[model samples]
Target: MFKDLYDVIVVGGGHAGSEAAAAAANLGSKTLLVTMSLQNIAQMSCNPAMGGIAKGQIVREIDALGGYSGIVSDNTAIQFKMLNKSKGPAMWSPRVQSDRMRFAEEWRLMLEGTPNLDFYQEMVKGLIIENGKVLGIRTSLGLEIRSKTVILTNGTFLNGLIHIGEKQFGGGRAGESAAYGITEDLVQAGFEAGRMKTGTPPRVDGRSLDYSKMNEEKGDDVPSKFSYLDSTKPLVHQRSCHMSYTSLEVHNILREGFDRSPMFNGRIKSLGPRYCPSIEDKINRFADKERHQLFVEPEGWKTCEVYVNGFSTSLPEDIQFKALRSVAGFENVKFFRPGYAIEYDYFPPTQLRHTLETKLVEGLYFAGQINGTTGYEEAASQGLMAGINAHLKINEKDPFILKRDEAYIGVLIDDLITKGTEEPYRMFTSRAEYRTLLRQDNADFRLTPMSHAIGLASEKRLRRMEVKKTASAQMVNFFRETSVTHQEANVVLAEKETALITQSDKMFKVFSRPQIDMQDMMKFEKVKEYIATHDLDTEILEQAEVQIKYSGYIDKERNNADKLHRLEDVKIPEDFDYDKIKSLSYEAKEKFKKIRPVTISQASRISGVSPSDISVLLIFMGR
Candidate 1:
């Protein structure tokens, strides 16, 4: 081997890069992580929290697959809540209000403790490409480090520009300097690049807020954690968030800065996240709404700073102050820092394969914001996968690709590499077709075996999974074998407003009722005795119940996915000429030739491709 050649080189040390480096090193690759500053590794760039809605599912999936994000979030969390608890188990997502500083420190310490990982502080300026393959990276200090495979998770630092009112500066974040050269180099190497903008809200002093005027939002009575591993427990005393709202006065003040607003004045040409808009954009778009909700959340347990969650703005400092003061609790607020928008370079992910490796540059991979994704969860999952694939490529092993039915991470990567997002992509429940089967409660059941097969998951995790499996199987068996008489089960069923049982029924059948839960079933002496004897954890019990309750829906989705996979397997020839197909419509021909979709199902999902067009293509391919 060359003097400084590493098996893998991971660029950037944000959420994606940190996870990527840790994963590659943990999987037996000698890895080098290059970042701008060591102190800023794994910093919460936009929010002082983790896991929300679909994002929480992604974090759990990461943890199940041997990634460290969930553990780190759990270690630093000040408050915990399981969102969407009123919905089905598939919709239940665990979230945490994290200590920002502690989260970064924990990630740094974890990476340092990994045996095969090495760290360097420097900005990667460009890659060393030889004959269409990435051989190494070149840093700003003119040091060249060779590696067999490289993963870029540069986040928002590639020629990043920050905007507040009309004042703009070149920086990755508020105080950090921008990275340069890589975007230009990639473009010259035949890669397509685009600009994307994302913003963060102002931080205010907690002591300055008048909380008595706002509504207090408390954590769930039974708090839950993010990690599948037993790394930490939920806090005994959780912090409470306050809720405020934007008044007409605040809207008027924000409108006053419209002339200098970069978003309005066309200074920001890139598309931002549709779901996460700035305060000015919200007021302008929903002009008829009387008010918008604002969440005042603490940054951490030790800091006096609070993050103004729903009040992201790029208005002038005076305008930000004048408008925030109009809100209920923020009437006497003082800002720790003003909110601003950052515009950064992103490569359309269509340029990458399913393995996250660049199609044009062999052995070079891209992840995180560099791939046009917005959230920390989205970035971390991508980074972990990219790191795994990079190490596999270096070792001459097969690429580790997750199927769409297997994980939310799979759905995310498949969407990115297939459709190529026009805006900054964030995860949503609606995006997954098989979400009925992809419950957060069963992430370990779905992913631990796969991770273990690939050598990323530990022996301890595999052993725990085995124990859980045995416990779940035993509990399920007991439920199926045990019967409850009408006299014993009728009252319990009626108490939940469900129909009273008329005859003896299996415990499994009763538990599967929509109205019944484990807690309610535990009222039966036999059920309680069985659970006590099995020594099953609440998570496994919940997972088994959901599996039984939603069996029909899950089966239906699986059948649908299997049917679609048939179409996916009917591959088109690489050089197939859509223009030569006379049966295809003019629009279909143009779109098919441009996108060059790999499968018939993908072509069918394209905007302009009709069902009739799909039939024509299928017939042409002898399907």
Candidate 2:
């Protein structure tokens, strides 16, 4: 039994669906999360980890927006690492290896505790639509539930087909039944759908691996967490992941099974993620390479299950076993399960607006794999936005849209709805043009206020953000104003092996040098006193250090972002006629009509829309 009419109904319970439900419920909407199995809520369907590269920034942004992903990740993390520490602050990302079971459990608990959310278990076979508008959902048992808006976060489950070598089966994932009907319904309803493929690595028994033959990858000495909140703590005792390699012999063994592979044999036609390719694909594509690296990661703190990273494949099980046995540490590996590739139906993101609402169907939204995004972080971010916007739509409020410079989430959505990815869209540092301003450390500074204004981020969150912001600004000011004597500066500079100044200079100038860092500055009595007197935490100090050190780069990026914001401000009316623009190229016109980008900046980012096309539009608009 379900409510007569719910505010929002979320189909599926993966990262995307979970975030969507949480966001809608937290925003005071009566939301229902319907999944095939409630037990697998927010499952880490691929890797048992969260955040990597630009994905980390997304988790931080989710946390900053009062979403539960970051908090859930921190609560379940068995190991913590801040990746790209050696790189600039802009490149730094926080990552975690999670206890798979706990990650899902924590998410369910968080969702259950939320006030306006309800849960149901069922397969949503079709949408309740009338006159090009979705009203609710129809379950497999012919049960109809009415809702004001429906969010389909059906990740990899729309007519899903799993491929394992020559053997193909209908399934969403390992041991899960495939969902059907919805794709056909939507297709018949005039939405264009395409197939996309993604794969997972095998799970093996950790006891079978030989750690002595591999390199141990430990967590950070002082591990950091994903959540900005004090709700969870950084991991203390941590598990170590081991790294091994695939030798020429291993590749030779794998190549023998290539004929049987779904990928090579043309049994699977859909495109998979190019970056995260299967082992067989990797070895075949890079034949010149003698060996490929493999990460042997533990699945949980207590479980003997291990995940064989970089070994995703859909070769014959015997072939998988034989090839993996030749690796450095997996000489006698025991399989928990073999890896397989799954192909699923996805609607072209071009059919969706910036709010993730379908252009074809009013009050209907799509997120996660349905939108052609690959990673959990990307899906979750989209889900959160979709949920927020869906609720706003029903309540007659302006939709919340993040801009390109403001967040990586903004860049992700903009790229999806604008470019329309053919392959699975993954977030990367290179994707965001204004990454310097979108650093992971300052996500709260960038997004908390906006989320707070929207009534999602709590007053406690706002207060915390305000306090951190004030403290960091004061610390940066101290660095700018305080001068260290040459005797003090040279000692610190000499220790860091940097050129010592002959005279006293502002600490900010000295600290701005690449060789100098916060540790060195903290050695100064004045700096240490300021930090102690202000009762500054690591977060505040780190934020201040980045601001002080990268102020010039930050200012330049902000200036660039501001200049571009003019184009973003130039809003195009919803019914703007692209067909009448005689000077526009055929491809540009087609893209404009399809994507229907709301702003000139969004229009400029469309793949085939050249700068000249933008100039023509600007002139036409009398800019």
Candidate 3:
């Protein structure tokens, strides 16, 4: 049944694979998406939600770069939130609780409508490798498929083993069958593979829970969306999520199953997510604490399925039920399925280049859990970059890489390749030093141009971004050029508990006051008149305000970024002889030779490579 060779073949249908397939196809590469089952495409395997903290920033970045995650999330959301709203703009991230079914369906619709993509339902059992390059994939039924490039986003599926108390099974997820042969083949082919574990909370019946005893959580009154483009509508109404607490009674019951617990009984040796630990782990780790919070999240608008957030476990069914029922709202809860942990194979990302292309095999790329990344946003972002780079690679073009100052996506890929992850890696706002410049509010402003240049972002998106930039610039200019009188400023400044202006001064100065904000400054008749005359929206108004207020910090960070970028420009040949430099430390020499950092900046960031090593390299290259 094989016909012609495809340009790019994506071997998974999870978040990473979906984005990868969409990106390659959108860039004019004829793509094929192979999955074990079509029904589970883009399935929210864990919680039925998208984005939080730094992860929300990543989704926005993905949206800015012509990826479908944001649009999909917007269309599927039952509730929306702007996390850290009281904090600085950089920490404010948009998150949404999605309809579990709708999220997957929207993704399916998006992929089907995409021009150059084709789908196949089959488990990829092995890769068709020749020499040092990937040719395509071999399916479970023994059919071979050919492609110019292969992206393995085989999230938690390669030889996956599931553990639940004393029971164990072979499965990729709760119900899906585990994929085999691929990991074995890759390992035999010189790739180093290790097992990583992750677990999900039991899906409980919503109708069985008691909301009256729990703290009701609602969405923000004003809902914001993910897509910078106007494709998705703003949410007007929203669903409710509830919060409940686990008591000492719950812990006692959970402890009853300790001996049979797979996590503590040595049935699972791999590390689970540190930030999101299982209920059993939490109780054990913080034994002095009286309670732990449990978020009761809905699975879908219509379905009775509910996700027991903060209750991930792999204990026996009886113990799980007993412990959950002891919690406030879960007193009557019943499981759709008990929670379990899955251990799967991953190749340490240090084996890959910054482009996500494997150094061991050309035309081969890895993303998602296969690279040890943990979240949907993290996986999807990596997939988007890998897909873009893969397409660019086949066409003899230089790879597209986002710098650390440019996007959170850049920080993620760089950290993975340069540092290498022993445990599942997660993204946090603290991870990016240039957080001030990479705020979620300005993702489109930062990445749309680059995406457009790569042929992924549309002309319409580019125009939209330009309009925002132009309007914001005009707004900033008006603030700088216009003068506000002491009388005009005092009314606003006095209310904010700040000093009154001595005389008429530029609006920029008034805006720069710590207590005053753009909204406060807008109270002046002249400032209000300028905004009304210009017809600027909140987005433009806010961007201009932040720029004027934090100009000093922004400029300082930008200067530092520029200085570091100088080292980034110092190119080091991939085949450079680090061992020949006897002046370098033995550890530095080994690390430099292993990483083969492409630039002096990258070499400096390597774990064992020190400043003196960089100086030695600088002196060597000086010749």
Candidate 4:
């Protein structure tokens, strides 16, 4: 029996839904989180890890904007790593191997502790829509729970179907039942829906595997965390993951099951992630390659369960075991469960605005896999933005948006809405041309202030961000103002293979050399004194160093971003008649009418709309 209407009703309890519910509630909205099972809240459905490559930068951005992902990840992490240390700061990303059970536990605790939040364990079947606005949702038990707005982060649950060899069943995940009614109802209501496929690797017993036979992959010597918040703890004791490879014999055995693989056969029609294909797909596509690597990752601190990374397949159980046994370290293997592929329905993201709200249905937003995204980080980031925008829209405030140069979150949303994803959309560094400005190291500098302005980021978070800002400024000033003599600079410069300095130069100038790094600069007495005098933390020092060193590239990107943003500033009336413009290209007119881009910049980014078309529109608009 429900009486009062909730401000926001979040469906499902995966990374996206949890963050969405938390964000709305934290911002003072009365929210409801409805999931089929509360125990599975924030479950690591695939690998027992968070943050990889471009996905890691997204977690940092989510944390900076006052989302719970980073804090929960830090609390449950058994290992921490800073990926790509050899590359530029733009390429550096933070990752953590989490305790699967602990990760979900932390999420439930966070949601229960947050004010203005309530939980309901029920499968949402349909929406209660009146005219074009979402009034509430309908559950399986015929209970109609009313809410002002609803954020659907169902995450591979809507009409879900699982495939393992020839066996098939309806399931949201491995052990959960599939959700019904919603996708059909939405489609009937004029929404376009499509199917996308994703798979998981088998969970094997770690004790059965001989770790001594495999190479060890260790965490960072000095661990770092995702959150800017001081309270988020870093891992003190980290477990080691092992690396093993599939041999020619293993491949030969795996090929035997290719006929039965749902991916290879005509069973699975949906497109799976191109970058994270199954082992069968990999071997089939790259037949000449003799070996493929697999990372043996522990699922928890105490549990013997280990996730077999890079070995995703829907082959028969016996065939999987036989092939896996052929691997060097997996000679004696025991599986907790066989891996399988699942196909789920997802609404084309083109149906939604950049705010993540559906254009056809007011107050109804979509996040996570339901919008065709593939990773935990990507889903969580969408949930964060969707929650923020849902709250703002309900309160009659303008939608909160971040520019492309500001964050990876912005780039993700923009890409999804502008160019609808045919397959599972995963984040990549190459997608963001402005990645130099969207570095993981400076997510807070880019987004926390904006979130704080929206009253979503806590005052404590804002204060913490301010401290880092002030300290970085102080450190940069010290380098910019203090001049180092050639004698002093040459000491570290010679060791770094840099040309010997001829005259005294500012510490900033000395740091600009390709070989000069923070550690190398630390050898100088002036740099040491500056750190001690100012009490600068490593994060602050690093920020100052990167900013000063990459200032040229950063400045150039900012100029380019500014120029593009000018086109973005050119507003286009929603659903404007493109047919009236006779001078426009036929493809541009069709695309413009379909995309309904809010700005000229968005129009320019569309695949069919060329630069010539953009110029025509700009001239028509008298820009």
Candidate 5:
């Protein structure tokens, strides 16, 4: 019951594997997605949510590239919000509260609908490598499935260790068993693997909660969907989450369990996410704070289960219950399940190329938790790229790698493959140098053309993008060419508390003023008539506004990126012996040899490789 060959075989059917399988198959690769359980494909292992901060940008990027994450998220979302709306456009992010069951089911349905994609339920135990190239994979049942490329997205399943207080079990998730054979084989093949831990909070029964004691957190008045393709429409009715806090009594009860806590007792040695710490770690770290906020989020519209955000822990069940009961609004609450931490193996991402293929093993790739990243969005984006590159490799086409200036996905891969990470890495707005140009409002603007050229973005999507581009240009042109009289602008200006303009001004110039809004400028009747005739979306208008307002900053960053491009273009030969460069320090040579950075720009980002070492390399190269 197995094929001898496949173009690509994706192991694990989580976020990364699902994306990888879909992308490769959609690109014409005869792909096989093998997982332990088909029903858990694209499962939200930790939480029932998607996107936040920089992660949202990644989802949009995936969508622009014709990936299914955005569409699945849109179809499954129960509530939606635009985070950081009051901030700059670069910081604006779209997040969704999704139905976990629907999210996974949607992914499975999307994959099933995709051509060239085949599904199998099995655990790949070893790789069949020939001459340092991945030839195929061998499963636990002694069957070998041949493939030109193998993408390993074994998220938190490889030798997974779950800790509940002092008790430990071998499982990827709460009840899911750990994967075996691959980790030992990879280690035997000289791949370095380390342990990293991540935990999820308890699930509570919504019916057991006292909603009157908590503050209601509603979705945005005008909710937005994730996909730009309009594959799914937004819901008419949205669900609401609640906000509650842990009191001093809760902290005291939690403290009672500290002695037996796995994290505190040194039972767990792996590092966890710093930004999303467990409640135990938070209380220990922020001792001065009397309370910590816990968000009561619904698991799905059809279920009464709620995920207790900001309440992650690995304490004993009794302690968990007691501590939870001490929190406000949870005094009479009951839990569906207790939280636990799982430690799993992750190979440092530096071992992979920008295309996500392993440098040591051709046609072999890794993504998601296997690569040491934490979030669902990060895993999904990496999966999509890995799938694309795997397909390209099988087709004998050039690898599709995005540059830092191109998309947030590019920045994520570049950073991971270049610098590597010791902890469970998560995306942040501060990581991207060209954030102003990478605004979420214009992800399609930046990536749709490339996706269309590559045959991922459909013709219909491209046509829609073209219309948006044309309409936005028309709006910009109207603003640049149209002039408004002082009398027409004075009324709006006075309303906004600005001094009246004595003469005519270009609409662009007027709109550029910090206090002026496009809606307010519509009072001139000319602006309103132009907008009504064009019938543009708010996104296009917002993009034009950001372009005009932040033109200076955007240009400056572009120039900076241009200057850095020269360094990026300077290739560092893989076999170039850093030890031969006598001017380089011992530490720099050791670091360079280990990382083997592809370019001088990447070499500069290495932790121990200093500016002086870069200068020495440049001088030695006769630059």
Candidate 6:
């Protein structure tokens, strides 16, 4: 049935594939998304939530760049929260609990409505590569479809093996069939393949749980959204999640099943995410701990199925039931489905360029779990970049690469390609050195203009970003230019229990103090008048407040980033021979040759490359 050649062919329809297909098609490419099951497009295979800590920043960045994840997340949200409100702006993150079924539906609908995008149901078995370049894909039915560029976002379906205690099965997810051939094909084609494991918790019937025994966690009084665009709004009503704990009794019951556990029995040897370990692994690792926390989260607004967060496991079903029964709130819990761990094939991301294209195969790219990343947000961001670069490369346009100071997406890709993750990689705010400059609040300001220039972000999105930028700047300037009297400042200062000012000063001066915030400055008539007259919203006000309060720290980070940019500007010749550098350390030489970093800044970030080694390289480069 396939007649005409396409620009991009995306294999797999999970978070990464969905974004990649959307981005490629939205950039004017004729894109086709081929998956094992079209109904499962963009499924939340693990959790029914998006955005957390650094991940929230990534979702916002995706939205700014015209990807549909943020918009879909906002549309399907059931609960919303701004994490780390008491922390610095850089630490502040927006997260949401979603209606699981709706989340996937929203994504599918968005992709269907997108121009130049098409969907097909099929398993891609192998790529049609010729002379080191990909031409298209060969389906399991032996149909050859042609495309200029191909993106692989196979997620965990690649030769997937699911383990539940001693019993095992060949399924990608609970009922989904495993995908084969592609891994073998790639491995035979000179790609290195590794196995990585990840797990999800059991889903219990919410009606059977006694919520009176647990503590309720509510959403924020005023919820915020993930998308910077005005297309989606924050939740007006929300659902409350419940918190429970696992006791020593519960731990003992779990211990009885250790001999049968796939994790403890070494039935699954691949490493799982370190930060998100299974409940069995947790008790085994932290034996001294009396108990562990577990959150009882509803799967959707109307469904009785509840996800048992922090209780991920691959223990036998009987053990899961017995142990969970001992928990405070789950005494009568009935299982919707038991948790299991899955191991799948992944390629070392060091083989990928910054644009996410494979270094060994021209016009071929890998994203999501195929690149060893764990979270949906991480996968989606990589997909977005891969799609954009694939379109650009085919069109003979410049590739888009976000700098470390620009977005969390940059740190994610750079870390993978440079350091290479042995375990499933996840993003964190602490991972980025210039976190102060890459805050979640200003992602639109940081990325929208660039995306617009690339023909990805729409003109309407660009205008909204520009309006926010101008309004926030005006607000910051208003604080700097307007002065407050001692009487007025003392009223606010005394209320906050801070030292009263003896004389009038710029509102910015008083607001810069640790105790003062935008609200305090808004207490001034002039500040309030400026906001009202300009009709500034909460987003604009928050942006201006962060700029005003954290101006010193922001400037310092900006200068540090600028200093690093000098090294970034020092490009290394692609064909430069690292073996000839006799003075360089053996480890440094190997890393330099393996990663083949395009810039000195990237070279310095490699794990084994020391300061002395950098000095040697700089001297050799005639710096």
Give the 10-residue window scoring lowest on summed lDDT in candidate 5.
Answer: 535-544
Q: State the TM-score for model 4.
A: 0.99
Task: Give lDDT for model 5.
Answer: 0.90
User: Which is better, 1 or 5, measured by TM-score?
Assistant: 5
Candidates in order have lDDT scores of 0.89, 0.93, 0.92, 0.93, 0.90, 0.94
Could you tell me every candidate's TM-score relative to the true structure? 0.96, 0.99, 0.99, 0.99, 0.98, 0.99
Candidate 6 structure quality by residue, lDDT tens digits, 20-123? 99999999999999999999999998878999888999999999999999999999999998999999999998999999999999999999999999888988
Q: After superposition, how far is residue 319 of candidate 3 from its true place, in Å?
A: 0.7
lDDT of 5 by residue, 1-623 (tens): 66557999999999999999999998888999999999899999888999989999999999999999999999999999999998878899999999999899999998999999889898888999877898889998999999999999999999999988989999989878999999887887778989999999999999999999999999999888888876688767999999999988889999999999999989899999999999999999999999999999998989999999999999998999999988878888888899999999999988888899988889999989899999999999999999999988888888898888888888899889877999999999898988987888889989989988877888988898888888887787888899999888888888999878999999888888878877787787887787778776777877778877777788998899999999999999889988779989898898888878888988898888889999999999777
Lowest summed lDDT over 10 consecutive residues: which window, candidate 2?
227-236
After superposing candidate 6 on the true structure, give the runs of residues whose Cα lies further than 4 Å from its correct spot: none
What TM-score would candidate 1 get against the native? 0.96
Give lDDT for model 2.
Answer: 0.93
Off by over 4 Å in 4: none
Question: What is the clash count of model 2?
Answer: 0
Clashes by residue pair, model 4 = none
Which residue pairs collide, candidate 3? none
